[model samples]
Target: MVRCSSLLVALCLVDTVTPWAPHAAQRWARHSARSANPQDVETARSADIVAVAESFGVDVNSRNKACCPFHDERTPSFTLNPDKGLYKCFGCGAGGDVIKLYRELANATFAEAVEALVKEDRPKTRRVAEVKEVDASERIQLKQANAVAQEVYAEALRHQTSGGARQYLRKRGINPKTAAAFGLGFARPGTARSLTKDMDKSAFVAAGVLYQDGRARFGSKVTFPIRDACGDTLGFGSRALKIRKDEAKYVNSPASAVFSKGSCLFGLDVAKDAIHATDEALLVEGYFDVLALHDAGCANAVGVLGVGVTPRQLETAARFSPSRRVVLALDADAAGDAAVRRLCDDVLPTLADESGVDVVVMRWPDGAKDAADFVAGRREQGETDAAIASAVRDLCAAATAWNDVDVCDIPINEADAASSSSSAPPDDPPPDDSQDELRKKIDELQKQLAELSAQVASS
Candidate 1:
């Protein structure tokens, strides 16, 4: 819980939430009428007392008396345990952690308050701009539609405990609890052909979670819910269920009103706090990669949902990373290679001019396919979280950008090209670091083989 709290606080510490001040009294009466979970209520309070107090207007930071948020007071009587994230106010005897504060302030039930705290990274206002503004009513309707879709998918996964989705998660080192925490689901083939069979066709389609073409787009796959920075359920990313040649390995909800792949980074809603706290954003290649790395103790990791890192996504990352430092960790395969090249050749140049955060590429360890595989193998080797984190930090430290190696984009204009042709090298340019390293490895292998042959001849 402390780990979750600290991670959350980094992104959302001072972000304003809904203006509940006016309706706080009414909400409290309603919340008190409902039953609540005692454990959840306690856990939320324990995560970050300072954040909770500050959010509710408590001047917990003052050495002098500060006004109590719970009651009208000019001077503060709040005692705090900074290490423990707990607080007690001497005035009005109002004392508790953030959960208690929320329960009091929002007049929210224990569960609702805890859930909101858990979603602390979500921004208070995240209405994205488009060509035409989305009206308030349309936004509410889309939100409701996606909410139902997420419920449907999650329920399917829950029932499929003995199903392939469970097996895939186990193989990937994701437990059911972690899956639930991330809102993972199974687009079960065992269920109806289309998840939205009973859902509103128009609304679900508009939300990009459904299609009326009589085909289930994400059928029989593990669903990773994609949300905006404000925690609105936008759409989903799904990986193939049964490994097959014909089916594409991965798929995502198409571009719709709620979801725009180019503008969205998976896990932003959850990891924004950690990103802001660390002043660094970790960009990965896919949803599982983000989850796997986070589960491996790197809380700031996010993914592009199989898309290349776009300028809009980088800008979004920059918002969370005030220091403007980001590390792009892609897979060790060809697609990953191309993605990194494009990032360096395209996005890097544009980003460089901004004088904002610097971007670095995290090269995979030898033979490591992707981040998820790397972390899983590290765990298999009995590596501690500290060791894995250290390794990640070291890899990031060694990061060398394409620009650092003097890689530059050539102008396509006739005049620029004619002038630069003489200076530009041939198509077979000198090998980069990766190529040079491979050559060295091949030379070493050849030498070892020759040595083995000599020994055999003597024998």
Candidate 2:
């Protein structure tokens, strides 16, 4: 029999049957006390505490000190008492049981904490079978709901043929094929309630498509279902089809059972094979940007629906190609620029540390807002496919050695230029020997000026 304490932790994490809000500590305790078997409680409890501490590289036996992740201290100030399955930090005055430790250290909610602990207890040999059973069932249910939602939204889009959604896509230059490839459909305002009338509204609510207050409340917004790599609709990201300068541009589904914004890559399902074939993935900001790239025949592209790239998404991308090379092509706006920087400083470094994946920023034309904007503007100017191809080739070439070169001067040697021309200008005419001393001073100043210029350019 499984130990009660360990079983409780495992059960908390694995069973999503309870609907209490994610981090309700009281609810978890009540549930654990009521449902957990007596024989398994102590052992389960000890195992969970040990596992969580071990995960943070804390020694289970040490009572005096353990690594403190909160501070930069080299010496350990945290103490763990394995006998009682508790921890206390001498330096920070932090004290907690296994659950509390998880909540603080992992930033996990009560439900998530429970689920994680339970998962850790699962035997390795049974893990695959258990996951398959759970995933298969959940996937089937999600696919069915998604299929229904997709059809309903598509039908609504047809009804609103002349509405703002159709116009919005057209304005963005998203063609029919490109739109369909992304399952781009419209949500009639207040239609979510009607569409999910016969279904379990809770499931829809959990998926972030429908709102609940005893009954469903579908807002007057056009919905875009965000799907996963396998084409299962995970959640909906909605936009106000009608033009309202005051309204928010888009509203995404809240955290739900099927959808995790962190784990889902917007176009990876459709772009997976292409990404794998090319051994590259283009990261973009929004859904439309991804569609635009695919429509333009650049199929090896995917986007994180939002700016933040999660560890799970990075791992998923790495699975496609061991040497994952992600080219970020975010927008030109301040938020977009910030996102790009975050991707470089935060997301990329973490991913590299975790998976050894390489990340590159795609150099967009200075004024272009995004990939869609880039493609649409190029098309409007009658730029031929050859021109677009050439631009992409240039970006890829630049990406290859972006790290090695001085960020200031991206060397652009004309392909047809003579080899000698690509090198430093032919030795400057020898300075007059009589004027050498004065000339040397002038040369030093010029070199200093050049160095300053390069530094300014890089910054």
Candidate 3:
């Protein structure tokens, strides 16, 4: 049986037909030419009208009546004459023989409706399925390469020779136990080719473990393995321990068959259960921030990895957090504020309307640079681990919903932003002249709007 909504949608999918004249002679000529059998039309005209109506998803009582489909009505005013194969809706004054009734209900032409009533086979709309272009064997090889590379890196971080790398972690307030739990690792200098020469170098290169020329991609850096929710090592994100002037502070694995930087959130593999338990996900901006929060006993925290959160990442977080709430605890700086604005103004409203998630922004404390910094500062001030955890939780609990946050309150002055430090910035407003300049712009826009309104009214 055809559902009303499905029928309506199908009608809309088809292009509108050329207008048909109401002349009986022309309709009969077209019907005869299309069907080629007068006996088929006779049989259709003599068929059971109630059954035909039922096939179109209309319910008729024993009295051979149903509520009008052409118009809204409480009472059943659509009477069907089964023997004569006719239907009449008194409410909308729609009276028709069986063929005309089919034509109107199916949004078909006089000839098409006749063909359908005669039980003829009809053409159907074709639907195409989406096909992925990635090769399964290539993806498997990439994952295997990443797994082996992760083991090698993890062993290097723990090796006696990696004292300098371990020291970097210690300075970041990450203990050995915490680092091991997150599968944190180090890639020693000059060991890229020597360490990975026995492995399939092509697979390693594809997995972002090694460059095309065979040098380790994350050499001389503290490596953070980026994993899927099920804990498969997909790629790596590394912070250069001693970056050259031309090098980035951090580097991530390039996009591959199995890894997408924008879609995968760091720490999500270990934090999903905690996010589910708490019905919330704490969002930060870097790998260390996630580790710091986890060490402080707030285990639901994950990182966007320095990029603004993408829709795929948000949807993945929503899968774990039943409440679908994400609390932002990004860096306490202008860049972080801009991320919050972009999420609120460009991302959240559309996502909320589609899947219904709530986004909240947690303002960082005055002297905190980021979550890792905040946790380290509290520890230095002799705060207990439990106290620090409770404080972090309380701050997140008191976060303002994005809807309530006034993004305009944050100035968009590039010069001021460039000069400001994360934890120690002078507390001075933008010069009064800038405010006056903004007021002038607002006044000009208002004047333009008023003039446009007057012109529209006059027109």
Candidate 4:
């Protein structure tokens, strides 16, 4: 079901139908003859709506709307939903997949459009056969590059006896087996002497595993491998081992053909199996927090990259566990406070149609920074494994419903109250006793509201 608001359909998927001609055999043959990579073919079949709109010089603003290309209009009516890769036009009723838009805008046959997109950004090369091979199968090459980079990093991590990253992991109490399971690695401190030193520069660079910054971009850091839902390595998240006032404590690989920030949740590849079994998710803040929680026997734990959880991430979460029992165990800081406010005020009201999905804010006691710290503290305090696990379970069990908009505390909207409070008929005698009863009820409600507000403020 597509969510409707401000001409936006919130739940449309990328894999939707495009307009096709009745004389399809000729077009299908032409389409089959193109040298399209697997990912490109999948993308065209289930198109990226934003890419199609961008190709037509449409600027989709923050509101995700652009001017209608089918017909000229000042106010924009065409809306593109990034979460689902879908586009719809309210004014002209021109709505379909990216292929349909390409056909309409270019005034070309489906074959022509598909061929044009398939050959986009093909690089000229020294050898004729290699260049042709690269152009013919670029997505496969990208995947192969990622796999090679993953192997190099994993091997570097496996032989980590002399590295500070191993010591750091030891200090954090992450076991060697857990580190191997998550593909954690160490980036050596020199630009020339590095793990990616022997790899083909173009491959690693395109895969987003190697950066061309003057210094090694991930130098002297612990690397966390980020993967797609299918467990394919996309990129790496880096944490500084030797922090300086000049450098950021945390940094990540730049967006490439595979990696898109905030579109992925860390540990999701491992956590999804557990989530599917339980139909619940334990969401945390950082990569290490997710690892620690998963290590502590909370197999359903997953972490987001940033402070605020986006609607797209929630939609991704919903796909795994349709039950929508996502427990947000973010840090107990100002950012977490703001996150909950957004979750309740903005994110929740829009999610009313998402069946029985409910987001619970799992608040920890004040001064406990985050889930990772809390788990580490438990280990330090000499708690048994069962006790530590029990404590973690209790934290989730004590979650509060973020969307607790009590009618007793605040009256329904003025329009609703006014409509409901209207008299039955003008000809009938007004019941003074009923009027008194209504007045008493309002007074009681106001008193209860004041008490509730006071309690909240005090807490």
- My TM-score estimates for the predictions, one after another, are 0.58, 0.57, 0.62, 0.58
Error of 2 at 70 (Å): 30
Root-mean-square deviation (CA) per prediction: 21.9, 20.7, 20.6, 19.4
Candidate 2, residue 82: lDDT: 64
Q: For this target, which candidate reaches the highest TM-score against the unseen true structure?
A: 3
Write candidate 3's Cα lDDT for 201-305 as tens digits. Answer: 777877878888878888889999998776778889999888799888898999876787877889988898899899899988999999988988989998987
Sorted on lDDT, best first, the list reads 3, 1, 4, 2
- Candidate 4, pairs of clashing residues: none
Predicted structure 1: lDDT: 0.66
TM-score winner between candidates 2 and 4: 4
Off by over 4 Å in 4: 1-139, 189-199, 213-215, 352-356, 405-459
Worst 10 residues of 2 by lDDT: 405-414
TM-score of 2: 0.57
Tell me the lDDT of model 3 at 265: 86
lDDT of 3 at 358: 76
The sequence of per-residue lDDT tens digits that candidate 2 reaches over residues 1-459 is 134344445445544433223323443444454343333433345555666777755554545456654332346777776668777665533555675576556654444444555556422231232322223355456656666777778767767453777777877777777777777777665566656667776556555556566332325455666766556677777666665776677787775446668767787778878877777777787887887777777887787787776655655554465366666666756566565544543344434533456767665673576788788778879987567656765675567321222222221222222353544454554346745665565566556656656766898
How do the residues 311-394 of candidate 4 rate in per-residue lDDT, one tens digit apiece?
556645655675667787787666766676666655554443322356777755524678787778787788765786688788
Q: Give the alpha carbon lDDT tens digit for every residue of 274-353 in model 1.
A: 88787788888888788887777777888887747676677567667766778887776657767766666545653454
How big is the positional error of residue 77 in model 1, measured in Å on the Cα after superposition? Answer: 30
